[model samples]
Target: MASYLAQEVQLARRHDEILSQRSVLLQQMETHLGDKKTEKTLQMLAADAAYKRNTALLNDIEAAEKRLQAGVHLQPHPNIVKIETLYWASVEESIPKWEQFLLGRAQTPVGFKKKKSSEYNISHAKVAAQR
Candidate 1:
């Protein structure tokens, strides 16, 4: 019984480690994805898909650990977390800054254009002639 308990404890510790790693990766993905609507951000998200894969692996480990502890003889169902999709959405949100940085400038869509008027309008004589 003590050996079984020890195994359970080990499994739980392993699960905890995986969960921690998964959490950190998700956080990183969130940071990269937030407000980063740019091509580079998309690429970063694509790379981050690996994190999702890792998360799934961790989920599998967790399920196995649970089964081991419960002495269950059935296969556990797969995890249904949508980590990749969530990360992708985050990356979409991060686009604005990425785009601004990539474009090297910010654009004002509704601001007024400056009018280029002469300081004295031809010293006022030109206006008087027109009048």
Candidate 2:
């Protein structure tokens, strides 16, 4: 019984650690997503909201883990919380693609016709006549 309790406590501690890492990753993702300049302002706002939601979920997970550690008997489950997976899926893959797309679009050069200089200078002629 004592061993089982100790194992449970260890598991809860591990879960807390995982949750903390996940929270950090989510925060990073939110920061990155917030920094991006999207073509559609509405999409940027929506992305911001998504980042916030992910952050909030991570926080909730951490809080739940804390409650579980404080003598709260929560249902036991395997470690399904993955920080790396979430980071890669949400931020790592998308940021590079978006950045590349933006960069590619920006690289397109704009052409403008240069104004030709007149061989005859009317202003010079006027000045010469005044002199």
Top lDDT prediction, candidate number = 1
Query: RMSDs, each prediction?
Result: 34.9, 36.4
Write candidate 2's Cα lDDT for 61-103 as tens digits: 9998898788556543444346556766897656654665567
Which runs of model 1 end up more than 4 angstroms from their true locations? Answer: 38-131
Off by over 4 Å in 2: 38-131
lDDT of 2 at 92: 63
Kindly provide the TM-score of model 2 when superposed on the true structure, using C-alpha atoms.
0.28
Global CA lDDT of candidate 2, please?
A: 0.75
Task: State the TM-score for model 1.
Answer: 0.28
lDDT of each: 0.77, 0.75
Per-residue CA lDDT of model 1 for 9-127, tens digit only, reads 99999999999999999999988777466767788888799889899999999999998988766545444236666778888887764677568686532333534467466657687
lDDT of 1: 0.77
- Deviation (Å) of 41 in candidate 2: 8.5
